[model samples]
Target: MSSLVPPAPAPALPALLTTVLPALESLTTALGIPRTVLASDEEIEYAWKDLPRELREIPAPLRGELVARMCVAVSTGLFDSAMNYIWNAAILQLRAKIRNFGVPIVAQILQSDFEERNLVELQDSRLLELSLKLNIVNEDGFFFLDQCRDVRNNFSAAHPTIGTINDREFTTFLNRCVRYALADASSPRGVDIGAFISAVKGARFNSSQNDVWVQRLSETHDAQRQMLIIMVHGIYCDPNTSEPSRLNALDICGALNSGFTASLRSELVHKHSEYAAKGDEPRHTASLQFFERLGLLINLNESEQHAIFYRAIERLWTVHNGMNNFYSEPPFAERLLELSKQSAIPETIQDQFVQVVMCCVIGNGYGVCRAAVSSYEQLIRSFSPREVALMIGLAATPATTLSRRISSHLSCSQRFKQSLTLIDPASVPSSVRATYDYYTR
Candidate 1:
């Protein structure tokens, strides 16, 4: 990847208007209009279909003229006119002939345009690159933003396909749901609370419905659904609550359910706030945790779903600190630990989350930070020798200096000696125990 720093800021828009806009206007004035107006969307499409042929037959000077003329249309608020030629003709030519059409073509286009006259006006190289990656301009690409009617018609007509949902709408619903939970007028009575708790239990395996209901709750200002989720969790975590009661059972499940749900709600809220506070990073870590929580709550067992969770978290930890740091916030870690102790979380998930955090520490350099070194020791102490040995092998290859530092610390630590001593040669697999022996020695 290129290491070029972001360009300086654009001169004020007025300066841009005074300079490039007028040059563009003069160029357009010189070209004048063709005999007929390409006014409508259909006419624009027809024009685009013919453009490739014209571009081929015309000389490079004339092609440049057309590009300059089209720039005027784009600048002058002739959206359809501009899009017709460039989006269909120029963009398609590059997409078919160019190997990596997305970023390079976009960069070239931005560079050649009058828009690039100002040093700071250019978009980030990475941002332009990623937009192409996600949009998939090649034949095999999944997303296309072109305004061609055929493409739109095909997409709309495709059936039995996974429907798309808006992150903004889901997040809006989540915030409203969380707020409603805290806004109930009075404390619950036993029967009403019991029924509420039952609904929370049902919600665990019905999370998609829960999502829709949360949106509904937001739209209607009805706190009933959300309040029940929080209420059941609160009650279930209370030791004094009767264990066998239906409400208690609901609370136990709901507590775990809300633990995951609430974490996502908080994360999305944090991200939304962060983006508003600062500009977006080119590569945003996709939140697999949010989807994983959804999958678990909804009883989804697809392998791809599982892979998405793992991949998302892996990419997340890679880009923005470690997984432990990501989840170590009080509400999440505390609840997860509580769930672990209470036998609410499945053993597999517990192992997965634990390993993920440990691996993230290795990946992101968290393990080697002087401040976190002691915390790393405390972390290893919390794990059984068996689990620790498993982690050592899993981290055979360290991606960052922090990971190497962690390896060094473990190799030298007294705790490592004690942990190694506890690794029974007979009970543990030779491969697992051998990894600990090799690392510590």
Candidate 2:
């Protein structure tokens, strides 16, 4: 192999400045402008020495027309103009990032109608703020970029210069712009809302399609990912949504479940609560189903959990008391067991939950629903300490259906004892140990 050759070293800073600054000074003098109007030779030399090294950090593709203009401004010792050129370039790149992140998503996040014109019209300060909110620039990036904005406004040629920035200050400003705005050229592209919605709604996502969409969501900015999650939840909760679409929504949400941020979880809970607060029963029911399907009911408040568990218990109890109870009870029993597995039974509903489960397990005089016994056993085994206590004391509450069944039927009493044995001994409270032994014995 041929030997690798090192490139030539850059020209000396003094030589470069000497060659360019004299011509610039002669031009200013010929125009009768004070020589003091431009940066001194020393400042020019300082900037020149740092310029090549700094520009090397920026990728070649980014060294476009505006960068060329910035270089020209620096060579002539017009540091203010150079600052303005670089700042404009940074602003353009930031706007491009937002555009690639999708304007509609920005609009959704801002809760405003943000078009391309609105984007173009945003003040530099407002743009930085929006960038922070969108996570386009992280906190550190935003901090420095905001300072750069202040510099552009106060000391750069973009506006009336309140003060002059020396070559060192200009280098710092350039470094901030490049580091915060231009350096991360590989930032995630925004997912297109229209295409995403269409794909989700069009058909069931196969494994490959699921992986692709999941990866897209994983790679997107947090703000967009959050907004997309909300939209998917809405779709899943929509009564008119197709079965395939609903499955698609569930698939996407389930894949991202483990990575759900606190803010995102809060948003979901807020949206879910809104459905209840508005008395939107269909949507509320669908929202509950969405949470249940994803095993996310634990994220809901206690009151919400109580409502869900109570309704499920009521449905299972009704089915147990109806005709063909044996055949009908299994599915309802299985559903309630599944719900209980999702979270602890809420304190407010624990008594009713235990009463209904015990009633079903003990059955009527005809005996327990055989097919449904396993579900009831699983649910009993999974009971929290409080639930175990409720269950142990349930037989002592006279005139209740479960109490009457256990008192009147030997088989029912024996089944009730068996159900109590499913509860882990550790879950039995010390205070309830005597009562738990009485029930199981």
Give me the runs in candidate 1 sitting further than 4 Å from their true place: 1-332, 335-355, 359-389, 398-403, 407-427
lDDT string, candidate 1, 296-365, tens digits: 4223233424454444334434433534554443333333333233223333443555455454334332
Residue range with the least summed lDDT across 10 consecutive positions in model 1: 181-190
Give the top-scoring candidate (lDDT). Answer: 2
TM-scores, all candidates, are 0.25, 0.71
Model 2 lDDT per residue over 142-177, tens place: 999999888889998878988898999999999999
Q: What is the C-alpha lDDT of each candidate?
A: 0.37, 0.87
On a 0 to 100 scale, what is the lDDT of residue 177 in model 2? 94
Which segments of model 2 are wrong by more than 4 Å? 1-89, 102-134, 138-144, 157-160, 165-179, 200-211, 238-244, 323-327, 362-374, 407-412, 439-441
